[model samples]
Target: MRRHELPRTHAAGRTYLVTGSTSGIGYFIAEQLARTGAHVILTARTAGKAELAQRAIRHSWPQAQLSTLSLDLADLSSVRAAAGHLATFADRLDGVVLNAGVLAQQTRRETVDGHELVYGTNHLGHFAFAAQIYPLLQNTLDSRIVTMSSYAARWATLDLTDLESSRAPYRGFATYKRSKLAQTIFAFELDRRLRRGQSSVSSLLAHPGGALDALSPKRPPMPVATTAQVLRARPLSLIAQGKDKAAWSAVRAVLDPQAHGGQLWGPRFLRSKGEPRQERPTAAMTDRVVAEQLWQLSEDATGVKWPSLSQPRRL
Candidate 1:
């Protein structure tokens, strides 16, 4: 687990898609998979960003097989277009790391479809994208989707009536936590449906404790850092680790063949930093009633359905 050493997955035909791969934990997830000789598709809001990420990965491992797609989750049209484009090339998807999303923003925002920006991008946008790509996953046995959630979600209070934060007061951090909770609920619900349908596809969740860029190793594709800046963040290293270490759970969720659906994997200690391990999900994430409510809300918002589910009405 050193910076220079790469884990050997020995995956050649395995195809994965990592959203928000331009930087942070997502970038490292793509990098990890690429190093193992896996085929990866790095997604970004624009074709240029995606291309740059592809080049960045290849620059390190010349044998890396990578592709790029332009996907703007804030725009429903863009999600549809990206899914369509992906279907043309990716006949099957072994796994997907749902990592693209905005963190806490200073002010409330809205997506192109008029939904609250944070919930729209982090939850609903991924909801649609996951639904659209469900067919590809179905085509591949044992395919899975790994959702990236946050420890902060433990602080959220779900008010389904004001799910969009339109009527409720919006504290940036609190609202962001709520969005993570929604997605976590969505992941569990998808796992339940996958089970009911008896499909081999799985849905799992993974989260980082607290990721610090300064503690992360510097690479040419990412932003440059000053020595002073690295030292300034050293005190925080006591609790948090770099995005490289934070990405371990996600990579395990993606590559572990023995992994089952409905399992939560995360950093080993205090939900912060260590090896990836199976962990219990918070009660809110596993509640069936709340998950069903969010699932309905997602379907209504996204106009996408899981083709595998024959009874999408009740489940």
Candidate 2:
């Protein structure tokens, strides 16, 4: 479906924060929210990129309620500072899309904080940000936190003993898959905690299955089995959907009235390309023990702990 043909739920007066909104799927997600009358807080690593995103959104919808904030997900200090700035915005936030992430590189690297780059940016940064700004979401009525994962998560084998890949040999694709798995686990664990605490806030996960977009610079070679799976997929990766369609899973998780916490959404076909829908995730992706372990590791790594709530708050 075209961007215009996707569901555009009314979001007038609601405020949403989208990380990595300067380009690609993040940009499209922000644009869709802004077009529906939501006040979109678009984040970029630099002032120039943020300005460009704002201009693009305004050009498309002159009346768009938009703002910009600087965020570098690879840097913990920057993530904290950005969260602090966002906390000052108002009493509450209607939604937050944790969409910023780094693609797999040819070699392993570490973030400024000394963790693996992909793990730090894709999972830990968002983890810290979410913990800090969770109060805002809790106060907001029926608020949602939509985290972006990836199909690469299916290939992940998270080693609790070597969460940072320091003790094991590092492969770029494996590291990237680990980061996505961390995100998936985080989302599910968060939802479980929220429900256990009886909080109104919801946590949802979404993935842009095989969309050809800016963040994905090129396709990496797959194993024989994975390659066959892709080949059998409808439409194949040769003609995969664009970022806008890939972003719909996230948009739906964010705005669809039927969407609920703890659900994972992705494309409707072959886990590659199609419209957004609820999809079954791998068993490892939904493993509660793994999720709890990851939650603890995230807290330790980021030094940010989620606030404990005794009961659900009225919206």
Best candidate, TM-score: 1
Candidate 1 local lDDT, 1-315, one digit each (tens): 443233446989889999889888899899999888889999988777677777777788789999888899999999999999999998779899999888987788999999989999999999999999888888787788999988888878778988788864677777799999998999999999888888878899999787888888876765755888789889988878888889888888888776788988888768888877888877888899998988888899888775765322210
> Against the hidden true structure, what lDDT does model 2 obtain?
0.83
Residues forming the 10-long window of minimal summed lDDT in candidate 1: 306-315
lDDT of 2 by residue, 1-315 (tens): 453366657888899999988888898889889988889999999888888778777876789999888899899899889888988765669899999999887777999999889889999999998888888888888899999999889889888988777755678888889999989988988888888888889999999887755323221221123444444643555547767778889998999898999999888778777788898878998899988888888999988888874365656
Highest-scoring model, lDDT: 1
The 0-to-1 C-alpha lDDT of every candidate, in the order given, reads: 0.85, 0.83
Per-model tally of clashing residue pairs = 0, 0
The TM-scores of all predictions, comma-separated, are 0.94, 0.89
RMSD for all candidates, in order, please: 3.3, 6.0
TM-score, cand. 1 vs. native: 0.94
lDDT of 2 at 223: 11
